[model samples]
Target: MMTSKIIEYANNLIKLTDEEAEQLSNAFKEVNIKKRQFIVQPNFTAKNRYYVLKGTLMAYVVTDEGHNHTITFAIDDWWITDYNSYIFQQPATMFIVALEDTIVLQIDHEKEHDLKKSNHKFETFFRIMAERGLASHQRRIISNLTQSAEERYENYASKYPQIVQRVPQYALASYLGMTTEFLSRIRNKRVAKKS
Candidate 1:
């Protein structure tokens, strides 16, 4: 029997009947990814959907200057993917990598399409997920445009307290649009003030 906890979690975002949960459990595959593992690589069309069960993942876009710019980070209970490539069957420009040893539940494109077709609620669930992703991207753009590096760091610290310690300063610095030196200075300042 499936646990009610999993059922409740699924139901919160999408209505899943008992039979549907059983089908979903059968369709989904669980993976254990080591830190630095690539979830989605560039030039590949991402064919799988992943639901993070533990740890953190970073999505980044490599620039012409050869820098890998952090696009976003996904922690526990979040989803990570190269959205445009996954949805439209296009080549991926972004790379999704595990920032820590992680566990995830994955369903490939074929299985996901079948699951959505099998239930209207599943389609609605994915629609909501897409909307949420777009909103998050928009907020990131606004923050990058209007917020200072210190402010962005503070926002990230408050919003994702769990990730602050787990993620490296270099990755966090990229996310905050600041140099590692700047992040180091900020951390040093904070430490000195607290002492």
Candidate 2:
């Protein structure tokens, strides 16, 4: 079942032959994460990259001032990892925590490297995923730089209504670079205008 999900995700990007599908499936292992569980934490190597099959997760870093600054979130069908740590096998500087009980398919660094080396299709698929992730981050950076706080909130709410609905207000607020009280005020204003 998990294999099918991973295969389906891959198939959406690039067609996979029976053998390739089997190989890809073999490369990943399933992990179950409880809500609030940490999958990647500071000082440990991020050995695996996770594909969310069932729930929500947030990647964040705790500042010296004891504030958590969200880096990204991954819900169903999304991917999350400390990319620098996973790619370089270095100690992590971020934490990846499940916001809900989650199931994921994870590929470790060595297996992923082997798979990419063994198959061009696998390599292409990974490259495509990486490129898309980079593009999304680029767009997010540009949006943050150019958009006002209220504009950013509006655009995020419009584009990811589901995420807004599912994520905790505090987490979402941090992700938007605003205080929870500020986010609440913005939301209240929006509701008042709508009414």
Candidate 3:
């Protein structure tokens, strides 16, 4: 069961009553995703929110030209989903992919609503979670607009070291708005200088 982990994560972010926590756990199901697997994809609707229990994942969009741009990365204790698609019942514009063989706790929309109805605190939890997502999105936009490629890479390396190791260099390069060749050059420079 997800009782312990849910309580732990919820307590860190938002407090939940005992009964509310139980209900929240009941709504969750453990799921495993293989590396490079798509958890959510464009043109399809997302019905669940996933909390990373192990390993890492990325949510991204791919252009018609086959260029991919990653939008978000989730690691242990982090949540991911195409919220707009899940909440509005529309097609997803992004795809969420497992960066490594991973495990996640998933809660579908219906179960989430049922849990929300059981307590105001639970509803508040989701509201806060959404707000955090918005804030993260805004921060990413500002960084992309103002930071240099090297600066962005450094920011990610410091902030999400686990992601740096679990995700492919190509995917990380796309997210940083740099070509794989440039990213490789930077990585090589770092390694050579360290040695």
lDDT of 3 by residue, 23-122 (tens): 7788899998999899899899999999988878899998899988978788889999998899997899999988889899999988888878978878
Residues 84-182, model 1: lDDT tens digits: 898898899999999889888887888889988988877887788889889988998999999988888888788888888888889889988999999
Model 3's number of clashes is: 0
Per-residue lDDT of 167 in model 3 = 82
Worst 10 residues of 2 by lDDT: 1-10
* Index of the highest-lDDT prediction: 2
- In order, what is each prediction's RMSD in angstroms? 1.9, 0.8, 1.5
Q: lDDT for every model?
A: 0.84, 0.95, 0.87
What TM-score number comes out for model 3?
A: 0.93
Rank the candidate models, highest TM-score first. Answer: 2, 3, 1
TM-score of 2: 0.98
Q: What does candidate 1 score on TM?
A: 0.92
- lDDT per residue for candidate 2 within 40-89, as digits (tens), equals 99999999999999999999999999999999999999999999999999
Q: What is residue 34's positional error in candidate 1, in angstroms?
A: 1.7
lDDT of 2: 0.95
Write down the TM-score of every candidate.
0.92, 0.98, 0.93
